[model samples]
Target: MTDAAPQGRLRARSLGVAAGALPTGPLNAITDVDGVLVGHATVDDGADLHTGVTAVVPPRLGLPAAVHTGNGYGKLVGSTQVDELGVLESPIVLTATLSVFRAADAVLTYLMRLRPDGLSFNPLVGETNDGFLSDIRRRPITEQHVLDALEGACGGLPAEGCVGAGTGTTALGYKAGIGTSSRRLVADGAPVTVGALVQANFGGVLTVQGTPMPVEEVLPGVRHEEPPGNSCMIVVATDARLDARRLGRLARRAIFAMGRVGASYAHGSGDYAIAFTTAPPQRPPLPDDRLDPVFAAVMDAVEESLLNSLFTATTTTGVHGHTSHAVPYDRLPIRPGTGG
Candidate 1:
């Protein structure tokens, strides 16, 4: 979390924000984790296509990584290999449900071109169906879109709310999009940073810091609706030395933030979390006992990031004139004086 604000984008911290005891890094974004970069390719082609791609490009490929499935209902490409082998060979990508295979192939193209000699790697692509607001069957995402996100990926505040893969997403009956937050921490005398980024496309009662904001009450004309099987894709990054096993545990803690924010984790919701460490491969892994601080940081950062998604988004109208209203700023029960 840098002293420089996200230009003018509103975040949870903007309104005198505090999610937990730990302090946030300068950027207060997932980019606070050294070497972790983010980029988005938003597609808005008139009425039919209102979806795109988001890429979380790590400094190096094949970093020690792991994925934890909060619910087993997603089209997460290349997850099994990472689960079995415990390493991520590709950048993490998020997109609409039908575009997953295309996203995977695009990454493969990016890799083979980069490693012309020879390359064997599994591309991790996570997806959430955005049919309610977009024409998903077209699967409009293309290789160019993935490459654009990857090539342009840089370290800084990632544009959130109704952008990239979140362009057509709806969460808790409100318009939801990309959201991010990070924490600065010390473990065993070693300084570490933990950050979370999410594609919040799921459902639940809207709650911020234990205070509830039912959809009907906040969005004047919006009706209460819970579409089954929607999803959320969570990415957790840390500079702490950790192995794939420990990363799995950390990933689970990241998903727990969904519950804290009132996520349904419903049967149709494909809730998944993937985590990685940018610590050099040669460094010793952090002790398990020292991980309590890391867990708290993850939960706090993730909860706030989800809130950021809702706060930053604008009301959107997509396919067939279907609309998803943004969570109104005036109506939110924000800690007085903290909201923008």
Candidate 2:
């Protein structure tokens, strides 16, 4: 696993900031789960365009999947079919709010070419409003952007902070973007991995390790371009033997952990979590009693992943010269063992 600081920024863990007691996978990323692949297509024109597409590709087709909505104010395409049929047919695509349908169509186009004989396909797509830093009305994302993300899918540590679907995102009064983390644990006598990737674009006080970050006190009149609430899209992947029902339960916990980082879940915030398992049980599934560890792992991974998003993101100036500053560690008190 390479260092989590991909863009000359520090990851939360690098500052000794973390959540929960569970150990992380080698890369501490969603790709830590074997066979899971992630890819991104960044459309930064250094002008009005600051949005892009992100793809989360599972190991195989027809995997058991589920969706949990914390607050359903934003668009999450293909969710009804995923909930009704309990399966994800195509790679999960994420982009700007207005670009969701186009991104879904791109996913459909990508899948149709592969399964030429198949009649119908359900493409999972989710989005958050990036209007503050992006000219969202322009709908800059293209079919090629979504397709490139799908085709460029790879394993290993994925990029984070101000990239892909997170390119124009803001959170907790600061710049935020794609972030990921994974946990390793044993369930029902079998080892399993649970990984999470988050697009942090919501609003709230920034909290870590039970302490609220003093964004106002430190920044002293920082730009608050976005409204009170926006949205956050979470994708949770695991190798545990869980079906749609179990995955739905898992998805709920991922959303619940948003409070760990002070997510408002405001009226307009669209908070959704999607959970899927790469390995469905061959024999009888692990009983419900064995799911406690996995549940704890999800909460921990989600909390840390959100923090990673903020810590690794740099100050960004977007459309109209509106700026969202990075977490000012130099002025703020956030450290390994103290409040920030």
Candidate 3:
């Protein structure tokens, strides 16, 4: 995993003991969720348009899974079947709102090309608005871009800030993009892995741990502002054994962690979370079979992943020349006696 800071002048420092005592996974990323792969298709043409696509492949083999939860505020295609059947037989694609159709088509093409054996393809694709930073009207995300992301999928620490679909994204009026974090949990004397990856585009009055700290409190010239349309699509994955029902519960708990970070679920913000478990499948008539241990790990991973999203994001600038500042490390009120 790369310890190097993001590729921008406004990058923040490392976690620096500010993340409490929770032990992060080897890569401190969603990729640590075994067999998971992440890829990016960032478009930086120097035309003041910074936007792209990102794909998260739960397993290269396209394991059968489930969504288990749904949100009306955002666009999550191919989730209906996922919720009804408790299986997600495809990769999850993330891209700007306007490019959803193109992304979906591209994903279909990629899958078809991969398995040219006449097998049907139904992909899960999520979106958040990036019109403020990119020429969304032009729909710059081409079929080629989608294919590139799929072909480039690999395991390791994912690049953060100004990369992938998060390139022009913002959070709490600050520049934000794709951020990830993970955690390991113990249940029934067994360890499990849970992880989260987020495409952050929301904005609001910045706060930390319930304390209302506006941007001005931390950085001069930084104002308390909101994006034209703010939203976030968070994806959580776990290797612990969990049924679809338990996975839904775990996904809902992620919203609580979002609240802890000071998000009130803004009116225009399409805040949504999708969670899944890679535990071995159970036979029919056993919905609750072997799920307790996995639930515990899901909760632990969701909490840590939310924190990582915030930490990994760096300041960014986008279309219309809007700029969001990075969170200042020195301004963080690290608790005493805690080695942050």
Candidate 4:
């Protein structure tokens, strides 16, 4: 429900830095998709902890969903079920790497409490290592934090950078966190919306629309110590009526978009993307021939979301006095009106 960026921080688009030419939805956020809600529960203790939970809620459970794993280097609870049966019975949750299990359990608890009659449930939970800036060993994410995030889910522009599961995360040698973007297009004369939310914690040679970012030269003395093998979690939502099979294709496009942002997919990176649709089940699936726009939208939204995560994040000092500096505007090679 919270959509406020950190004080004095601006998103990638605000800085005239954009990823694609596709038009964004009204909020330019994942929540722009009708019936999709997002919320965050940040647990910043101000001393050693910088971790939390992010919840993405759909209109209902048992929705058609699919997941694509770019690299299976990290844990993703309930991914097998989603990949096999193509059913998402619970809201998707993202959190710190070490606390994924606790976050998953909390999600089950919340869903069970909401629908006591449901016997079997599959809770999808994803994570990225935040140990660089958080006391990951403490496992600070409690069940209450998950509950708060799930209960507070709302339909609006969600906050970006240094919040929710993105807290303490660093990407591409820069401090990064939660970011979201959406694309609006017309397919077969009917409007369709595709939205994406990303927890960017991986590393690579940063790029903006094919232009490489010279971090060392631009931001002198800023530490880029986070390894190239962290992770990234992407959740995509749409209002298009699509089946699980086609949704899987859409999910893969989301991961492929990572390359657009220069994701390394290193040995230890666990890159995954999950796509789900909110269109009513009674609606017929959109034919595959008309899916080009949808796929393009997914790629653009994912790319933009990654940039927003880094651009909006602020520098932070965490456990063991480790610091992750934010990617400043001056570091980028592209700017407004100059044409990247």
Q: List per-candidate RMSD values in Å.
A: 1.8, 2.0, 3.3, 2.2
Write down the TM-score of every candidate: 0.95, 0.96, 0.87, 0.95
Residue-level lDDT of model 2, residues 1-340, one tens digit each, is 4455778887777776767888899999999999999999999988778899989999988988999999999999999999998998878888999999999999999999989999988889999998888989899889999999999999988889989999999998889999999999999999999999999899989887777875777688664555434899999999998989999999999999999999888989999999999895575566788899999999999998998888888888888888888987664345543521
In Å, residue 173's CA in model 4 sits off its true spot by 0.5
lDDT of 4: 0.88
136-190: candidate 1 lDDT, tens digit per residue: 9998999999999999999878888888998889898788889989999899899
Worst lDDT window (10 residues) for model 4? 1-10
- CA displacement after TM-score superposition, residue 200 of candidate 1 (Å): 0.5
3 or 4, greater by lDDT: 4
Question: Which parts of model 4 are misplaced by more than 4 Å?
Answer: 1-6, 336-340
lDDT of each: 0.86, 0.88, 0.69, 0.88
- The reply for model 1, stretches above 4 Å from the true place, is 1-9
lDDT of 3: 0.69
